[model samples]
Target: MRRKAYDDLLAWKNGKTKQALLVTGARQIGKTYLIREFGGGEYDHVAEFNLATDDVTRESFLAARSADDLALRISIAADGPLVPGHTLVFIDEVQECPNVVTYIKTLVDRGEYDYVLSGSLLGVELENVRSYPVGYMSELMMFPMDFEEFCWATGLADQAFAMARDCFERQTPVPDFLHERLSALFHRYLLTGGMPDVVAAFVRDNAVDNVRTLQADIRRFYNRDITQYAPRDRRLVIQEIYRMIPGQLNNPTRRFKVGDIADVQRFSQVQDEFLWLSRANVALPVYNVDEPKGPLRAAEERRLLKLFYSDVGLLTGTYEKRSTLGILDGLGTQSGETSSSHDRMNFGGVYENVVAQELVAHGFAPYYFTGKKVGELDFLIEDADGRIRALEIKSGSRFRSHAALDKALVAPGYGIDEAIVFAETNVERDGKVLYLPVYMVSLLHRTRQLV
Candidate 1:
């Protein structure tokens, strides 16, 4: 499968001042796969070492006294020679031996072979490393396949994505046929998500049930990690927080309330657990900004926040607990199944979550605004030009603006001249607001660049 991160790896590899690269993301999001793919294709010789599974390799690193010694041992361990400029040395599961991270400084100082290190728990484990090779390491964050990458993997041509980008740049509705096709594809993406494993399975068999099963297994793996890595007493708290994500998102306020899952009256008591999930890349938290401005994070309300699962497919699998293929196929409600009012509410949350995912994938820090008298704006975004824009996400065709968005657009302090509404509607402009179909959310970052 194609990944945008691959291009980043290439840039790092070809840079003038090269540093050891550290690839970080949640487990199973393809950090390992991407590094290996880059190494196999870009290097004449690839020395791959996985510390998690290779005890001998770990022992060699521990025994080495110098970069040259470590290099020789790693070359032997990889059953290959590490040549300068032509070889790529990849260290997988570096969290298992955090000390290995510090070795990057030595390796880079020696200027022998190019190095790439990857770990699922790098953020958590880095705390214990003897020293962080601060200047010697470059980091790239990997995320689940975005919509464009998903399109590439599923046999859609690059031109298709280009066409979508062109439409977004022009602020025009896509041709009806392409819009319908993309809408159907986006629905499948909601269920299959950008998880490479789930996407590959669905593409191969065209079975939503199989994808759901894989997603469930992925969830189990994450739970197991919490149990295995979290402090013994806090494991249950972390698990409770993880399980409450779907319900929290469904709340009308769209803020994660610690009290909803636990009996805690204060967020500080469980704040570390929330941080743990975010650091682990299992949850993406959107903070509440009291004021919308250039430095949005300055006025963040830490106590009020929304947490979204890292992948929308996993969220759907956990929330729906059944195959959504029928729903995607126009069979609204399946026979013999009764969906509650809460289930109906979840549809909006799911749509919002997907928009959040797309925004995050494109390097936006998700923030939202709730006004006492004006109403709520689903998201507040700052474009490349440092302009704050209000984004409202609507799940259905009945698109209507709230006073908060209108107020933010024209308010003196807000400085937001235009607002964007993402809904099941075609692209159109209404006064200062632009109405766009939900799928176009993925094109937002690119559209900003064009503007």
Candidate 2:
């Protein structure tokens, strides 16, 4: 499947970067496959090793004394001398032997071969990989296939996006036929998600059941990771927190209350558990901001927040089949799944989750705004131009009644000029507000740089 990160790999390879490349993300996000694909085409010989599955090689890497010794050990394992400049030395599952990262700098300095390293759980596992070569590494964070990549995998034509972008900029409605079809496809994208393996299976079999099954398998893998990577005492807490994501989001406020996990538990007690999950890339927590400002992080209230699954497809797998049908058929606003104690008629949480995923993948830090006077906005993001914009997700038919957005527009002190209502409707603008289809969330993006 086509991925946006492949371009990043190509740029790293062609840039002749002296720094070794580090590809990091949650497991099964296609980190290994992407690197091997790039290395195979760009290098005459791609020597690959995985520390997770190969114990002897892991020991060899850890015992190496110098850059020359590291190269010799790798060549011995590869069964021959690696070509000086034509070879790409690829390391996988470096989380098992993080010292390999420290070696990356020395190897790059030798300039014998191009080096690329990748692993999962690095945020939690590699924290102690002492002596990290800060400037000697270029890092890339890989997310699940975003909607645009999903569109490409599912055979949606390129012109469709071109047309949508045109209509979005022109403030015109998409043709009725295209709008209806695109909406349906957007639903499919939500169910299948951006997970490459699941997306590929859906593309080939076109089976929702198979997609659900595969997504479930990935969730199970995540469960096993908790046992393996998380601290023994924190494992149960992390596991429970992961399972609670769906029901937590279903709440009216969509705020993750620590008390719900256990009546006596407090946020300060399990703060590290939440950090573990966040760093592992298993769950995404969008904090509440005191005020929507240029740097949204300044006002972020970490304790009061909404937590979403890393992928929406995995999220849907946690629910019953009826909820899935409700989403597909566009039956009503509420999923109406009554099996769980936290069940609700509202599907706003699911819609909010998808939008959150889209925003994070597009390189934006999304926050929710709730105030005594301004009410709650589903999402607030600071644009590249350093102005905050309010975003709302209307999953129900009552999309027109946006009290929060209306209030914020003229709330006096916020200085908010524009608000977007992402609903299941055609494109239109009402003064400072722009109403866009839910699928167009993929189009909300801008490039930014840090000082």
Candidate 3:
């Protein structure tokens, strides 16, 4: 599978002054696979090390005194030669041996061989290591495949995405046939998500049961990590918060309520627990902004927030297990068929989750707006021109705006000139608001550039 991060790896390899690269993300998102693939294609020899499984490799890092010494030990362990400018040295699962992180500075200073380091729970494990090579390493964040990458992996042609982009740029409706086809594909994405293994299973076998099984296995792996890595006394609290994600999203307000899971009266009691989860990349939280204005982060409401599962496929699997609904059976609705009303209602949360996931993947901090006398806006974003835009997400075709959006559009202090509504409708404009299908959320970055 192709990943957008591959291009970043290439840039790092060919830079004028290169430094060791660190790739960080949640587990099962393909960080290791991408680095290995890039190393194999771009270098003469690739020396790979896995600290999680090989005790000899971990011991070698502890014994080495200099960059040259470390290179010699890594070559021996990898059964390969580390030639200057000819070999790509990859360190996998480095978090398992956090002591080695600081040594990256020495290797980069030597500037002999290219280096790439990847790990899961990197931030959590870094806290245990005393010192870090902060200035000596360039960092890149990896995410589950975005919509366009998912299309490429699933056999969609480049022209298809180009057509969608053109439509979005011109603010024109896609041809009816293309719109239906993309909608069906988007629905499938909701079930399979961007996890490489889960998506590969669906593409190869076209079996929903297989996909569901894999999602459950991934969830189990995450559960095990919580037990293994979290502090002993807080293990139960972390698990409780993880299990309560789906229910918290179902609330009408959509802000995570600590009282729902435990008897805590103040968020301060569980603030660290939430931060731990966020750092692990298991949960994506959208902080509330009291006033919609410049520097959105300035007015953030830390206590009032919404939490979304990192992967939508996992969210759907958990929802199915709790509801006992046959969500997998509804995968055939990608051909313009309407899902049952029950399924539609269930998809509301899934739709919002995908929007949040895409926004984060595209380098946007998600924020929401709510007024006392007015209503709530689903999402708020700043465009390239420094104008705040209100985004409302609706799962059904009967989309409507609330007074809050109208007020924000004209409010001098708010500075929102345009509002966007994402729903199951064709592209159209209503006064200052533009209505687009939910799948077009992936094209938002390009649309912003065009504006």
Candidate 4:
């Protein structure tokens, strides 16, 4: 998997006062595999349990009176003995029993063993639980692989992934071959969608048809999960929202409107479903950042909000756009014809989302910025140091948006340090603004030197 989250687990393991850890992500996003692979290799003895199975084990643990006693019983229930320094205890699907979170806090306070907890429906489960173990658990979010990680993991570390870090860091030109390959790979990623199994299969076979089959299987899993978890009436609304994503993004505004769902639908019926998807971690709602302040909350943005799926693959899978990749990958036609079609596909939306994915991966949650009278920026990322950087992504060859950048830079009392433009050419500064190619977004911290 080659995940950065694995490194987070390592830090928690070595901490002087480590808490019980919770690993959260969507189903089939490799939360379980990450823990097993990283834990098995790093620890002496790994004791794991799946709360979805074995009712007796659940009852026994829940019946315990003390955290120390519960830890001992959980170890015994897992068919292993607790060895504090040697064993790393893992609880999978802990959301099936949210009270276990309390027990985990007790274990952290009293027991000597290190613990790793993981679950897909933790968001929904948290709603049912009394309180979260805030101070007692370190949370590690495991999203689907980003494009660079996917490339490295699938034995296809092309020029794009290799140059991205350097492009943004040094503000240097990317090799021509790398840019072309990245453009191609960017299209491929849109189809395969960053699920580990799908990517592994795509790289192994080099067959788009096989990738489509895998995506369909994953889509089936998601549909079934929604049917089981979401309310019966709202299930259809959720499906409608999922179906509307691609077309909605194709709009110029890119903000989801209820009318975009179809010819006949009310926002009242679908808003709750949108919240449900957010709660299930199926989608991310990027609120408009009006104030551009610390902890940019929903209040900062009055009316605008955009929604994105957690993984592009799931988006493609659920939307039944598996054929879009065929046009993207230069397949099923004469060479010249395929080239023109590929160029027309204009991989912009996927690239914009890819940039968003990497920013989230780097520990910053991005918000979209727009104003009724002013203008719009594609992304606004606030770093740990309280610096809010505005990012504008342009996948096209032409560099526009200078006017919008000017408006954003001098809007009211906001201090825009320097704007970042991700495009094809490295256009030098316009006063304090910086123009960088899309390939360099991952390395923006280094590009900060230009500011």
Candidate 5:
């Protein structure tokens, strides 16, 4: 329930010439709850309205003559006067009424009221919203809780979280006790996801079944949106694309190639649908990085773009029980499922994407390295000095340095400062690359200087 984004809102409230703000994120990410928590505590009076649940109120605003009249209508609906500096008005699910975006823009432009509008999906509503107060309004992006935040929330706080936060200068090695606990929780997070409701359930019941049920409910919400939000013709295509996510990410080439989708019939039909999904924040496109520099331009090959869902747990939910063999071992039983061939391929790809997702959330952009012949580096992470650090992520621990990694290091111009091979446990260096556990990837961002 504690989110750092709320702090940004407070800072915005206290700023000079503060404008109405718009908060955007995927569905059920606690957008509404965040506004209420932040606004109620910061302002003298809080008036909240949901455009999706309250249609009559929306209709009244639509019929109003001007922005001032619309604000007056909202105040009447809330059974209070909209007083500036005293009231913080919040409109949740603003995507449910596209017309309101323009109205809010006009109100902010005309200085009618201080407000915050939150939307789970704005791609559907952007069609009608015109003349956005671009310069006047601040847009805030909210993401699912990161590993550190999750630890703090679940009462698992220890040195790992502290170290990741850079509370100290030197890198603190995760002690054995902390590593084991964190490893288990990380696996659980990969299963249950950061969806607020599911996370709350896990915290409340601590039951795997409860978490799975909640995950299913979130999937159902997504499935329903395919029909509810997308056009009839685009509905099935969107559904198919959604279904292909787990398999696509699990491929030897993590990129989402058109050939991977069975019964594609046509790739063009699904392309726009995929873009819509990305706009909704349900799917994130990890572009193939040809350059490690800032603005990390996507490769000329558009087909190389990889697709990752908003949550790792949501991705796992799509696979059948049998297919998830090595991908995950489930609650507490480690059955050594990684031995199977199918499990090996699928599991490896998923874990790589997981690492990629986590690193991206931590302000690191990942790029892959491929040799002229046959080897490939899983990722090339650029540190603060603009130095490229090559990294290879494995499923568990069974990884041998590839020829591509060797070729990458010896290549002409690109000078890699350090090479890392991330596995299941910390180990010594193998030739050019240093071996580290997958859990230690967060620590890769900073250098370990001895005191």
Candidate 6:
């Protein structure tokens, strides 16, 4: 039930940043719950509004003239007094009223109360701002429960996580007992995924059927969002692309081909739909990079990319039945044996998607690299220091023979010092490449770039 984002909120309040706070994430990603928790604990009063469900407030927002007018209109709908310096004015579902972003500056200048907003589709709907609210608002992007946060929800102690972190930093292996336990939890995470309600259900009752039901409901909710929010002309296409994500990742190259979705040849044809899914916070696109270098953005081959679900577990749910057996069935087998079997079982894409989600949660913009001379590299990211690090996600024990990774390290001008391979194996090293247990990805957080 705990979230790493909770700490981010606490820091924002304690620091008195003075900017209107906006928390953006996919629906059911706990944006409202966490903000409510903060408002209750930190303020004497919470003047909260939910724009999506409150019809009167939605109409009032449209009719309001200025920050003062909007504040008064919203305050009339709030539960309690809006006291200066003692209240948190929380606005939820701002996607319904994107103008809230424009008026937030005057609201902050009023100096009446601390402002906070939560919304999905901020990426898609908050276009009136010209840019996504710079200088006037502080934005935080949230995602599903990562492995470490999942550990806390599952009641794994601080001491155990500290042990795993220490071993990872020191380049040592975890003990047999704790290693197996964490590995099992990682598989369970793959099975349950990170959606808040689904994770809560599994933790509260050890029922897999209930887990699948909640996941199904979440997917249906997203489908409804497409119907309600997506452009009228493209709703069907968006839904079709969303459904194709699981099958696309299951392909050998893991590249999402625009041509496969329709008879189209160029990415321009469906680029908006792809961007909509990403901006709506439901899907993730890891574009291909032409070179492995610093400032990975400059090298992006935007047309070529791999698409993954925002939640790995949600991706698993699309498999129709007994998705749990696919991931856990082959654990602890030799790396090579698992690799071959994973192809048949459709687990490779799931593992890759899990790594993509973890890297993103830890503040890395993931990309893949490939060429005729070099082989296929799974993920490449810039670290806190802006150095390039190559990552390979191994679904099984055959982790030793990575042709692409080996070539990338030795290539001239790459300046790559070491590589990371997150496999179902204990921590070990072969020269410059450090192999880590998949569960330790929780510790790979790049916690820098604070202003």
Model 4 regions more than 4 Å off: 16-18, 53-69, 156-164, 180-183, 231-233, 259-271, 291-295, 317-343, 401-403, 410-412, 424-433, 444-451
lDDT scores in order: 0.79, 0.84, 0.79, 0.68, 0.67, 0.84
Candidate 2 local lDDT, residue 17? 55
Better of 4 and 6 by lDDT: 6
Query: Relative to the unseen true structure, what is the C-alpha lDDT of residue 412 in candidate 5, on a scale of 0 to 100?
Result: 63
Q: Of the candidates numbered 3 and 5, which has the greater lDDT value?
A: 3
Worst 10 residues of 6 by lDDT: 332-341
* lDDT for each residue of candidate 6 in 1-451, tens digit (9 for 90 to 100): 7898888888877775558888888999888998998888888999888898988888899787777899889788887887888999998998888778878888887778899888888887886563444676777899998988887889999899999999999989999999988988888899888988899998999767898888889989999999988999889889999999988987777899788876668899898999999999899999998888878999999899999999988988878665347566444232235333443464678888899999888888999998787788899988778888898888865777788899988888775655999888899999889999888877887873223
TM-score of each: 0.93, 0.95, 0.92, 0.84, 0.85, 0.95
Better of 2 and 3 by TM-score: 2
Residues 1-451 of candidate 4 have per-residue lDDT tens digits of 6876677777777763747888887887888988999878898888888877867777776677766777668867866667778888898888776777877777777657788888876776667666677778887777787767676776665554656556655656566776666657655776777788888888888777777788778767767778888888778878778666666665555677876665546656566778887777767766687665456554356245677777776555544454454535433221112234542444445556667666765666778777765677778877666677888776554455555667877777775555888766553556667786554565543111100
RMSD of 6: 2.2
Q: Which pairs of residues clash in candidate 4, taking residues 3 or more apart in a chain or in different chains?
A: 168-440, 193-313
Candidate 6 colliding pairs, count: 4
lDDT score, residue 233, model 1? 85
Off by over 4 Å in 3: 65-69, 321-344, 446-451
Model 5 residue 305 CA deviation in Å = 2.2
Residue-level lDDT tens digits of model 5 in 33-65: 889998778877888888888889878766876
lDDT of 2 by residue, 1-451 (tens): 7788888888877875578988888888889988888887788888899988999999998898776787778888884458988988889998887878877887898777888888999889989877898878888888888888998987889999899989998989999988887888888887888899999898899888888899899999999999998999889989999999999988878989899886436788888988999899988889998886657888898878899988988888778866566677443363322333232346678788889998988889999989888788889988888878899888877777888889888876785656999988999998888999999999988662211
Q: Rank the candidates by TM-score, best first.
A: 6, 2, 1, 3, 5, 4
Give the 10-residue window scoring lowest on summed lDDT in candidate 5: 328-337
Model 2 scores a TM of 0.95
lDDT per residue for candidate 1 within 140-247, as digits (tens), equals: 888899887787888987887788778888998888988887778887888889999999999999887799899999999999999988889889999999999987
